[model samples]
Target: MASDRKIYKFDEVVHHNKTKDCWLIINGKVYDVTPFMDDHPGGDEVLLSATGKDATNDFEDVGHSDSARDMMGKYYIGEIDKATVPLKRTYAPPQQAQYNPDKTPEFVIKILQFLVPLLILGLAFAVRHYTKEK
Candidate 1:
């Protein structure tokens, strides 16, 4: 059988499943779009079939809230070719740094890296002042 299914971009908001009943990814997170799409008031065709394209235009016309816009990038699951697609890095909470008793060596390195620029600036000023007196 010929399938009309299309491959979508991960940056595009989507919701899909083997049965196509559950809203697996909406705007970016896994959501239950099964009941919502059917009852979506704006009609289900656009939202349900919008799996593989930039659904931003469709979503804007649907009158969703600012929070919905925020969620859009969270559920987008599409193509991931770093060379072609410019991927937006969404900060995940569990993956981010948190208050811990032990200090991370990586954090120490980053702090030192930040200080290096200031040190260079100070060195440049000192050299300029010393050379002016000579």
Candidate 2:
């Protein structure tokens, strides 16, 4: 059997608020596909046609790899009927985080080195406390 495997049918719609994109639901789950529309190898038109509509027929036609099928389950949220799904026009900017790999390795090493001693000390104290109780 396919582990965590899901099958999407033709009647379901997936709402992805973050990317302002809606995916068609197949079986029982949602898939976030805002990022894929523009980057898709088939071109934006194909993706656009399916926007706010069930794209189950379109997706099967385009051909995705087995791995892509497997990873799709993580993005599932909920379901909507194709006719009731709304179009999202606004796109949110990418989220920014403080820690990016662009920072030098030396800086990363320094941070790790600083944290290591404190972690060791904390562990040592925990061990001592547990031993004393025993």
Candidate 3:
């Protein structure tokens, strides 16, 4: 059965991200979701947003009903070539320092913590006085 199914590469899937040519991968299977976009119960945007991408997580995250899962058969186009699928990468901005609350000076944070409530209280009293005068 697997040999009978068409196989698509990652680049080929990425090319179909647009609304008119949407394709998605879920659990190593490629699906052309263009026709089903308008009919999707979750609306077209949900389908379009996953176009030309691996939507396995997105699809599973939604906790789709059994009926929805069953309906996927209609859009099954092929299986992805596992070797061609790109590895997911974590992005870190160059030359940017990560914020660490633990590393921050306690004195500065303490001053900010104290000032915030005082500022809020002062603003509230001012607003109350202004509203009373009106």
Candidate 4:
């Protein structure tokens, strides 16, 4: 039965990324979701954002319900040519610097902001008390 499905090129699927004309390729299957765009629970922008690429990750991440999964058949148009799909690069986000409570400039500044005023007021009170006693 899979052999009967039409195959679409990756380049051809790239063109339908607009609100009025949108297509999505998820797990190699092509779906023309234009009609369901406005009706989509996440709104049309969510579907439009997944265009021009393999949206399998995006689709799976949302954890779509079984009914949602079954609904794909209605929009099913074809399968994408595996050979035409480009290899995507793995994303590794930049590591954040380790926060050292004893060394961070922001932490030091916050401590100083609190303590400096207290120290100033204490010194002012001490000076006033001493001068008044004299």
Best candidate according to TM-score: 4
Which 10 consecutive positions of candidate 2 have the poorest summed lDDT?
10-19
Task: Tell me the whole-model lDDT of each prediction, alpha carbons only.
Answer: 0.47, 0.55, 0.77, 0.84
Q: Mark the regions of model 2 whose C-alpha exceeds 4 Å error after superposition.
A: 1-20, 81-134
Candidate 4 lDDT, tens digit per residue, 1-134?
A: 87898999988988887767888999889999989976999977688778877889999999999999999999999999989988973432222234534247887899999999999999999999989954
TM-score, one value per model: 0.31, 0.38, 0.62, 0.64
lDDT of 1 by residue, 39-95 (tens): 455645545544443334555566888876665444443333223223443431121
Error of 2 at 125 (Å): 82
Model 3, 24-83: lDDT tens per residue?
Answer: 899999988889865778866687667555789999999999998898999899999888
Candidate 1 global lDDT: 0.47
lDDT (C-alpha) at residue 37 in model 2: 53
Clashing pairs in 2: 7-27, 8-26, 8-27, 9-26, 9-27, 12-25
Model 4 stretches with alpha carbons more than 4 Å out: 89-134
lDDT of 3: 0.77
Q: After superposition, how far is residue 67 of candidate 1 from its true place, in Å?
A: 8.7
